[model samples]
Target: MKLPASGEGDVSPAVHHLVKGSAGGVTALFAHATGFHGRVWEPTARRLPGIDGHALDLRGHGDTVMPEGYDYPWAAFGDDILAAVDGLGRSGAGTGSGPVVGIGHSCGGAALVLAEAARPGTFAGLWLFEPAAFPPPAPGEVQHNPLVEPTKRRRPAFPDRSEALRNYTSKSPMDAFDPEVLAAYVEHGFTDEGDHVRLKCRPLDESQVYVSSLVANVYDAMAEVRCPVLLVQGAETPSGRFGKLTSQFPDARLEAHPDLSHFGPLTHPERIAASIRVWLEGLGTRI
Candidate 1:
């Protein structure tokens, strides 16, 4: 899939994406988590037999040029995803199968919710894996995100691609992920600088996404997504309980994977794919 600077009524930086599978198959639009690009979704996408997958590299993250001011909040991200979905539908593929499915992990999943909210009937179904959305805050309560400061201080450059890959593959949360997924992350997550490769998404920019978490009405937005929804979360991850959100929709099911954590989608792509495949099949068997 090509990157369009703007579509579906909004001007923002173009979103980069990759496509796979036959055009005749049902279209599956996927969004990645924070700090990663679209290719991270490949391992999972490849496993779905009859679904054409379009995985996107969101703003400031991949080939998509990051706009100035680091102000592309969650609302902006949702518009970007919505435009991409329209771009795919305009391609004249998978019309017989109904609206495409929306798949997202972490912040990506939250963006999908905003997209479906902004544009009704954008998807036939949704598959969200531990999306980073929170319920209504308590009375006079404050929310302090732990990830912002750490992410801001994160190292932004590596001596070499090998070192970057090694550092990532040898780490904890990332270390547990599939080798192929990690490779894809490193490949699309950085660009070459003069003497080394710097991260495409600078630490500040990545943290900005985390910092802007509460700028939108996340809890209220859940009602806008009324399509068949499958909510998947790691049993052990905090903020994974979304029973309240799921209950708001007419057709929604929640699943908890006892053995996984927040990064379940990346760590266990095959297992996650199997679960999603079953849901997609229930939506409509691919030709």
Candidate 2:
């Protein structure tokens, strides 16, 4: 689906998304991490029954069309999430009829926080994994994000999807991902060209996203979110300061997995799905 930047009363380039599952049940809106697309949630969505899932591609990622000369801003990512939820309501997908849950990872998790803060009551609850919701750097402080250069150095092309899959399965971070999730990433995260397939999210664009994260104040907006939140992170690989973040939210809990990593959602979909199910059950929401 294509939607406006801020959903309603706002206009900007179209945002692309994929929706599935039957309506009249819980509605789930999924936002992906930087350099990853919406379809990466397919594995987790499959485990979730009776949920209307809407997975969105943020600007400059996946199939979302990025306007020329517009560098990615973290705030705009929040707008894109709002637009995706609004699109669901317009499509009669039961956005209001049932609970709306925001499931996000890494930067996607930060976007969800920004969205709910920007528009209170947009999400009934939020399930985030290692959300990159860092406090903004001090004024005039030199910001140094360690991930920027590595992101800029990412390989953007492969001889074929098979080669891409092989390389990722053998590589460091992606090698830790679930096979099915990695398959979905290999299939939907790239576009076919004459002789090769190129990653839809350019290395430079992804690097810009990291650079923008340095200035993002998503942590400050945490207090604006009034809904219950479940923050999940790998004990072995905590991304941000969860203790401080939990204190900022009105009602929130943090869970750490000893064996999981920052990519826990992708690396262990079943475990993540079980956690989501248990949390929803605790909230008295039907599966």
Candidate 3:
């Protein structure tokens, strides 16, 4: 299951990840969204008890630290996905596994798609939740990601974990999450910086990810995906409704849950997991 890096001598940092699910089951890789650590997938991973899950804290978002001068290009995330999937094989997580599937949210989901695009047959299937990609720019249209300013405006350092918890619990998106999930975000989402707690994922770094939306034309890559792709979207995803997403992939299904949001995987892991479980069953022995 070793996948080659896309560029010559362009080495990516080894990803930091955690595994879940039963030992003898399908191998699944989970990627998190912007401003979140990999542990955020714990709830959903647990729901997929039949899946052997691996969760990655992509680059700057979690415990994995990038070397100095690392350029957070959109393509680099694709490389990281390939490297992480390759790592699962080295750890025997992907070896002799029933199925190797990728499950991701937003940026994470898009990365999985890019990884599959880079190396066909690398994954058995894909489950993506409102991954951030749009049709290619119209000729010379400039990059116009709306989240950059909002990310820049985010508070960089929290006084303490309790304060962080309170802030998120009282905040907009986080307010919509489960208490346990919110606690998880506060626990692993930040680090101690002197007397204060700084965000594990820097604000500018996350903004860079959002602003680099066009790093690759995922819409163009969608047509080349040979594996089954299940596009998951919440009832009210801020990314809007991508109704045409199913037509882009060769073998794709769309699931728009009525009560979910962009970060629904965090708040409704069991629900999302159940959806995945049903999808796997429908796939029969392939999963």
Candidate 4:
């Protein structure tokens, strides 16, 4: 099947994506986690059979461009996913036998849950991979971590596009990816500035994004999701935190992989795809 162009323009100053799959069955819309672009799902998308797929670059990440001083909030991200879903429906991709599936990784998973909760039964099912749902740091317990909070609060300015790409690839957990994969990420993760290039995500903005996750609550929203939920977690991941609440969903099921890390989708896409295929088939949803 022809793979449709996956990136598009959004009205909210954010980047949108819609990857078409040739499966001619149910359509799946996937969102990537923080620090990664939507294309990370490409490997898994290629592995699923009989289904068309769509992946979006959430605001402030990947190809999505955000306005200056924009601190991405959890609610806005949720709205953006909904917009992507509506865009697909309008594009005539919503037709087929099965319900539309919303697949999300890390914080993207939380956004999906919130979107579904905002509108009950909006998706046929949900496939989430270790959504990063940490409890809010107690009143004064929040500490400073440079990894999560870079020294320069604003988006970094590199000497050139190549330098920007180097900075991104050097710091990414996805450095282990093939050269081509790494290139694809760098291509979407940076932008040219005059004669130089810089990361599109500002340091302070990203820090705010992380903190937003800590305080956001999707439990009530999860309860509202009427669709079946398939949670694929890294077994090595300790229990508690968000992992402990996996069982709360009405029809939720969990699958833990012993060797994968938080970045399983990038590190082990094939396995993630295989597991998703099995789960999708078991759901008996059309295409």
Highest TM-score: which candidate?
1
On lDDT, the stronger of 1 and 4 is 1
Per residue, candidate 3 scores C-alpha lDDT tens digits across 1-287 of 22333332444433433444555567888888888877888767766756677777777777765554455777677777887777667666553456688889988888888889989998888989888778656788876778889898899898899998888888798898877678877898899989899988888888877877756667777888899888988885454446677678989988888678777888887788888888777765564
Error of 3 at 26 (Å): 0.3
Instruction: After superposing candidate 1 on the true structure, give the runs of residues whose Cα lies further than 4 Å from its correct spot.
Output: 5-19, 91-98, 236-240, 285-287
lDDT of each: 0.78, 0.82, 0.76, 0.70
Worst 10 residues of 3 by lDDT: 1-10
For model 2, the run of ten residues with the poorest summed lDDT:
8-17
The lDDT ranking, best first, is 2, 1, 3, 4
Native-referenced Cα lDDT, model 1:
0.78
Per-residue lDDT value at 35 in model 2 = 91
Tell how far residue 265 is off in model 4, in angstroms. 0.7
Residues 3-49 of candidate 4 have per-residue lDDT tens digits of 22222234332333344555446788888887666776776787786
Backbone collisions counted per model = 0, 0, 0, 5
Candidate 1 residue-wise lDDT, 56-100, digit = tens: 677777766575566657887887787777665555433345457
Of models 1 and 2, which has the larger TM-score? 1
TM-score for each candidate, following the candidate numbering: 0.91, 0.90, 0.89, 0.82
Writing each residue's lDDT as its tens digit, candidate 2 over 73-107 gives: 78888888888787767766544577788999999
Cα displacement (angstroms), candidate 4, residue 158, comes to 4.0
